[model samples]
Target: MPFPIIRLDYMQISIEKLSHAYGSVEVLNDINLTFEPGEIAVIIGPSGCGKSTLLRLMGGLEEPSKGAAYIAGQAPEGSLNPLTYIFQDFALLPWRTVAGNISLVLEDHKLSKQQSKAIIDDVLARTNLSEFHDALPHQLSGGMKQRVAIARALAVSPAFLLMDEPLSALDSQTRELLMDDLVALWSREAFSACYVTHNLAEAVRLGHKVIVLSRRPGKVREVVEISIPLNERRERAAELEEVQQQLWHMMREEALAADRELADV
Candidate 1:
């Protein structure tokens, strides 16, 4: 029998006047926003705008210099990690088998062997990695390695996924395929996440609410809402295209200026 989809609680992530700085350099400033459970909040901005830093703050991986990034409400029962990260570089151990890579995360939770195996099996099946269970990271393509990283994230039963350019490393074709996989996975078991990406298409395709940030000392410049349902986004691609274009227009000038500033530095 398949492992049943666990009912998750109503968790809400809120960023309240959140500011952060590295030495004297301020990266993010007073970034306040809120996203509820079952929604994907995509953060997009020019490079050096601290999108990843905001994600780290959300996940409590770093302490902000000022303000707060906090979650309200309980994580689902049996969640080993309430907040999990899926990084751009599929950070799997080079030597571990697919199953072993997943098992590593569970080890710290002290789950019984049976529980660990069950979690691993369930996530692998959900991610369509069942047949590749014993494969090493090197044996898989770029997309498949990412799929394993995703499956590993799922094994922890995350309340919120802090994805930092999770698909940016893949070629265009592979990235497209992975986006489809993500939408399909979301359809099965609704999950919440703060996804950081520089790609506007990715922001439009995956984000329920796309939060656009300004250049350095990044602040919430705009929050563009997509009313289309996730399952219908493909058929409604034209509409999403317009929204994507709108986002591009909003970021274009700042992006250019941000680029020039980097060039000078």
Candidate 2:
């Protein structure tokens, strides 16, 4: 029997010969890629490979020096609300309660009290932070703080989510736990995400597809599709390890070349 056909609306994002520079130092060069809607694409590379810079360009935090970045069809007009970012540092306002932080962006939308409250409640439940709505940032652990960051980003209901090493700061145990939570959230929310990370294991475990970037003046080296399902694995350690090794092999030469270049500089 033939397999059922799945229709994807394909909210296509494209970058064409994009390049960015800070003064004389160039960060990205001739970078071209596309992201399809409802897909989780992770960017991985050695440190300072412009992985985060590319994400920032996608998020509209920074403009490319050359070429173009497009979402859907045309470039966004005026202020774009289609993209939101989750930072590595849980940039939660210390003074605001968990719910307050999540609701912060909603205020600008002129949402009614009832409408805002509904979204807050729903996202809180989805992120498993319903019980800590009134808690302060300091009261939560590292993993919980990142959860608040994720919840806050989701509260905006964006078309695309940009995450920059959101799990890098936590301890191993906490990172693993949050990784599971992240996979669960992605499965349920189905938001298109472009996550930047140096962790190959995290990339393999969480991404539907992974893109590896080259050294300084970063460009795409490869794009890999992950075949395993998150829920299918009873234990992720062995699977993650195997994929991690494969990813490392793919990146080994680039990483070493990058190191040598940096040392010479």
Candidate 3:
């Protein structure tokens, strides 16, 4: 019988000298990054570069093997709302209806039935999943299921949203469509995010700043600021492509180096 205990506000997440290792082998080393409120920082790197591990650290799900992750405006783990994570797979419970899946996050919180319904309804509407409230995961298209997952995350009003290739599972066309939806949603909600992916186009299309990590045992190779205004985002398609190309070149260089190292081994 507890009441909701937190307010929804932007959170500042910063990582400093963060490193993680599994036994003697390392996955991420001296990684440093920061995500400001109202911005998306997309992280791109080769496989095994610990992009997901970095997100886990940022979400406070795992302790850093070195350095630390910091979150401003922190709250207790059991608070009504905490950090939310969206995975590449739409992790909705198959047994639950769309509405039921969204309601799962509200369970730990103390809220009147009316209030919970209101939150769920609003989120469904926001994610364009209002009509699918009665749908089951098995019945939904990949895109629709992802929207339901997004709505569930939004229902909790997380301070920061951590995503790990959340759109990777979708086909190319669906991925592109959802990317547009995400940019629009993020524009309206201003939620801070750390999105990890291997897709540079997705990174440039959605990120305010893109962080490129070197090969395995990731380290920050470069930080690129994308200044394309939202209004001009699509209109100025050339600019976005230019930025993407720049990121591609950087990544290409890193990829060659990784190949050379592998050959030596």
Candidate 4:
């Protein structure tokens, strides 16, 4: 069977000669890239290569010092926020239950109580959190907390997601489980995202295209495309390993150099 074709027809993201700096320190330089709708694009690089910084710029959280990232076309019709973010910290309100946390995003839109409940219910079901809808943050584990964050993001019906190592805080087993959950969600919905991570195996496992950057003052070094379908990746672990090795070869030296530089500081 062929993979289903799901596209957000007029939603293409363009990064134009993008650069960012903090006072005297430059972080990214002259970066150019494009991200199509409904595809997961993973960005991997050495420790100080500004992967998260680039994501922040793309999501409009920060202004670029010398360039711009803009969407070329319109977002999906029902999207409340055209771009939203999922951070590694989970960012859930400890005082709120899962459903309440999701409702927080919808509150500012002047929605009726019924309308808000419907949206919250939909997102919770989508993220496999329906059973935990009333659970508070402390009652859940790390992975579950991240799921709530993802659900909150989804409640907005975002056109694109800016994910900054959303799985990094979990233990290895929890991380793997969450990756599987993400794969299943993407397979069913085909939502697009720009994901940032330092883990190559994660890039290989979740990315449709992997963008590599050099050490700090990050520049686009390479963009590796994985033609394999997301649903088939688990069974094709050997093939994915080969691709991971290729990425490792490209970044190992820069990774070591970056590590040493951080140590010196």
Model 2, span 35-144: residue lDDT tens: 87778899999877899999999878899899888776432232225788989998999999999998887888877899889989988998889999999999999999
TM-score of each: 0.95, 0.89, 0.90, 0.95
Query: Predictions ranked by lDDT, top down?
Result: 4, 1, 3, 2
Q: Please give the RMSD to the true structure for each candidate, in Å.
A: 5.3, 4.4, 5.8, 3.8
The superposed Cα distance between candidate 2 and the true structure at residue 16, in angstroms, equals 1.3
Q: How far out, in Å, is residue 67 in model 3?
A: 1.0
Q: State each model's CA lDDT, in order.
A: 0.91, 0.83, 0.84, 0.91
lDDT (0-100) at residue 88 of candidate 1? 96
Predicted candidate 3, C-alpha RMSD: 5.8
- Candidate 2 deviant stretches above 4 angstroms: 1-10, 73-80, 233-240, 260-265
TM-score of 1: 0.95
Candidate 4 is scored at a TM of 0.95
- Taking the tens digit of each residue's C-alpha lDDT, what string does model 3 give over 153-208? 88888777889899999999999889889988977877778899999878888888
Clashes of each: 0, 0, 0, 0
Cα-lDDT of candidate 4? 0.91
* lDDT digits (tens) for residues 20-57 of candidate 4: 99887899999998887889999999997999999999
Candidate number that wins on lDDT, 1 or 3: 1
